[model samples]
Target: MMEQNQSGRSLLKQMTLREKIGQMLLCGFHGTEASGDIERLLTEVPIGGVIYFARNVESPEQVERLSKGLQHIARGRGNLPLWISIDQEGGMVARITEGISLMPGQMAIAAAGSLEDAYEAARISGLELKSMGINMNFAPVLDINNNPANPVIGVRSFGEEPEAVAEFGVHTIRGLQDACLAATAKHFPGHGDTDIDSHLDLPVIAHGRERVERVELVPFRAAIAAGVDAMMSAHIYFPALEPQRLPVTLSPAVLSGLLRKELGYEGLIVTDCMEMDAIAVHYGTVEAAVMAVEAGADLVLISHTAKLQRESFGALVQAVESGRISEKRIDESVLRLLTYKAKRGLLRMDADEPAAVAGREKDNAMSLAAAAPEQAERVERGDRSHLDVARRISENSITLVRDEEGMLPLKLERTLVITVATEVTTIADEQLVQAPTLGSALADCGLEVVDLTVSPEDVASDSARLLQAAEAEGVKQIVVGTYNAVNPSGDPQRRLIGRLNRLGKPVAVVALRSPYDLLAIPDASVYVAAYESRPLAMQSIARALTGQIPFAGKLPVSLK
Candidate 1:
């Protein structure tokens, strides 16, 4: 370890100022293929890493080729291996979903009440991401979802209880790291308990230091104790931590004083994207990038906008040249990055071939072997095993919130499954591709189903028409799926449920996204919480509704 540290420092010393500045940047581009602007950025700027979003992903083969191609570009530039990162947190936040294992979100995992399930789910996700050449995962959200109205981090969080979030989060960190994929415990100190999303506007956490430590910082402390590889700083402001009301991403008091000194965190401190509205709209992107590094962030991520990416890199270079930010401080972060890369076997300065330095010779051989017919068959068979784990987690996370009128296990031959179309709630959540609706899942379960899809705006405006539709003569039972009906926008969905209760048809309300929907539609005969609207959760909900499996999940958050 000591020799490795010295070697990393030696490599750090050999870096030019521009190369050192590039090491602090993690950028993103806009393409499925890497031949355009991304190629130029990698060659000219030599960014330390790249983040993959939904737009950059198409299929398993395309993703593998993209990741490998990006690393090859970095190698050609004589740079260390690039950190290929993705937000594969499963559920709605997953970027690569088609061929990879899609596990439940943190809330769903906590709802299942199994620490082993949490660990196993993360392990599966990590292994699959590693197979696709992704080295870092921005995942295992450490936020505690205590607020019911939080738009962005509802089901992304583990649970409301601090201790549960801490325990479950630690297990997930261990799983991802053990799989040889760097796990990032994120949106620190916490993005929960705020109604606003940092992607749009800055949210403030006004809690005192005591409450913040007790609730918000619980999981983060646990993650640090577990030796998590990285942490993504939140853009939310904490009045108790920083007096200036600046987002934590650019606050020296929070990032330097609180996280570095008080917490004694030695790993990388990565800022959430600098282009987010919390920073971009308020502080400007290039200015925030310099402040983030000055604030003790080891990496400043500027995902999207190559113009901003180039400008931020140049701005950091100027900050160092002007002596506003010391070269020693810059070297500190580069050394940390080098040390981490070396520890992960992603750096070997003594090697002549960059492929050997990146340990990609074996990966290249494996890629070739994967082209063989038998290897493809083996890969398909392995995917099944991972899918089963995902299915089990989804099944265990199906919470039967209520059945006061005993309307479960629908005995009716024909049922009306009314599903509200899910809107992209936040920038962090992907626009789901052919997300299975509750009606389709019910149809799969052998019900004579009449399916109706309504948007929240339409439901809010045309509740009577929806009610008339639900009152169709042959439909004996009504199953309505609500996506975050607790929001004021979902009043029409809540009203439609109330009107459906008057029809004498048994009403079973399924909370697809947020479990707190039951709080608004209290009179529904039955209520079930699926936590997410993803395909696996829909399948589990369908099975649980048909009595094929019992609802074994406990509520991870308070609905009352």
Candidate 2:
């Protein structure tokens, strides 16, 4: 029998210098199909993993085939099994949408008021991803949502409190790992307190070491203690950690000294996408890749730009040969990568198999057999039973911040549903097309729903026209779907609400995304914080509006 304790060194000894360096990169490709570039990438360059985005995904079947095809190529090329990763964090940052159950985001789980629920949501999310052969999820964001103006992480966070974040994040990590998937606690030390989105530009976190340890590092410490498989570095600059204000992705002090030595995180450290402007704007792609590895990141994530990926690979190869990067450093990361793959049964390929057409076909057949059950169970995961959890959680997350006039539970008559979401925006990706709005759900509840779509800039004119029509139709009340009413774009919604109030009409405002919307538009007669605007959230809002369900959820985040 083979030894149970096969050392990483044993695996490292079998690899060439080029293969060792190739094991550090995690890249993303353009097409849905297995193109020649991707084939070459897996066979020749042989990156450690590939990350998927909405652009690369079309359906569950497509993703299954894509993942299997990539794995087939990797196995056929005598490479270690690829780590197929995605940001399947549910709510907003979900890459696999159509066939997966879109559960509420982190804050919603926290707001649902149960650690068990948080774990279950993650378990289901992991199940859905693993079914598609995706082994890594860049999820369970350990960031605490302390900043109201946080452009990227609002609902993506668990809550504003560090303890709550730790409590929920730990369970979430357990859930993902339970399903044979690796859970990644991300944006360390923390990206929650910043108001800027790092994708567009770098944001500086000017906290002292004391405050940083006290607040920002709380959940990350908890995550490490919980035994998370991976942690993704944030691109935000920490002035306290390094006087030069280097981003954590390129900071040895942060990644090595703090996360590794201080926190004692033995798992893999994956960098946020190198293609983001936060890193790419300052250091060139090749320079950034070299620096990330030097900074102690086990994996450098370059999610797009194939040209930059090739350049980065060449630069790493040159750096290793020129003694700029020690061979030992390369071995250290490769060991971690091999050890990780070994644990996940990725290194269990047949030795006698040829690395050609026969091998590829056999691997493809095995993958298809494994993926069939997963695809079959896809619809089952989103069945009525699972959706009930969403409904219950959504209803539980509905925080009633204000209802002074108590205009809720409006009778099913002459109620105009004015949803002001001409275009929805999320930090992950700009959603050009609006999803099904709350008007349809309200209409399902027997209310006379007058759905009027309006861009934030056009809200004034749109409101005027809509209100006039409502008045002519003898509409008695208004329900506004304030998706991002706290954003600068929501100025027109505030104006429209003011106009409606002056007209002596009762307005029930639904804060679709963030609970901070209540702070922005305080004058509304009735206020409900749905925490999300997904269909389940819409159903919860509908139920809450018509008095079908009670507002049982406590405010996870402070409105003050």
- Judged by TM-score, which candidate is best? 1
Which 10 successive residues of model 1 have the least lDDT summed?
Answer: 364-373
* Model 2 TM-score, 2 decimals: 0.93
Stretches of candidate 2 above 4 Å error? 1-5, 349-383, 422-427, 430-433
What clash count does candidate 1 reach? 0
Please write out the lDDT profile of model 1 over residues 1-560, one tens digit for every residue.
Answer: 46556766656655678988898999989998878999999878968899999999999789888987887777766666788888888887899878778888988999999999899989888777777778789998999999988989999999899999999999999999877788999999999899998999999999999999888999999999999989999999999999997999999999889998999988999999999999999999999999999999999999999999999999999999999999999999988887776655566535333232223342211011111111111234138888888899899999987898888897747898888887887899865775778999989999899988887778877776677777778888989999889997888888888888888888899998889888888787699998988888888999999999999999989977
Estimate, for each residue in 1-560, the C-alpha lDDT of model 2 and write its tens digit. 12312445555665678778778999998888766677777766868889988877888879878888888777667566788899888776677667667788888888889899888888877777777788889988989889989888998899889989999999999999887788999989999989888887899989899999999899899899888989999999998997666899999999998999989988899999998888999887789999999999999999888888889999999998899999999888887776666555455434333223222332311121122123324435465666677667778988787788878787777877877663445548434335577888888887887777666667766776976855754788888888677877778888777777776778888887878987788787688888777777788888888888888777778987
How close to the true structure is residue 170 of candidate 2, measured as C-alpha lDDT?
A: 94
lDDT of the structure predicted as candidate 2 = 0.79
C-alpha lDDT of residue 509 in model 1: 92
The lDDT for every candidate, in the order shown, is: 0.85, 0.79
Residue 404 miss distance in model 1 (angstroms): 0.6
Q: By lDDT, who's the top model here?
A: 1
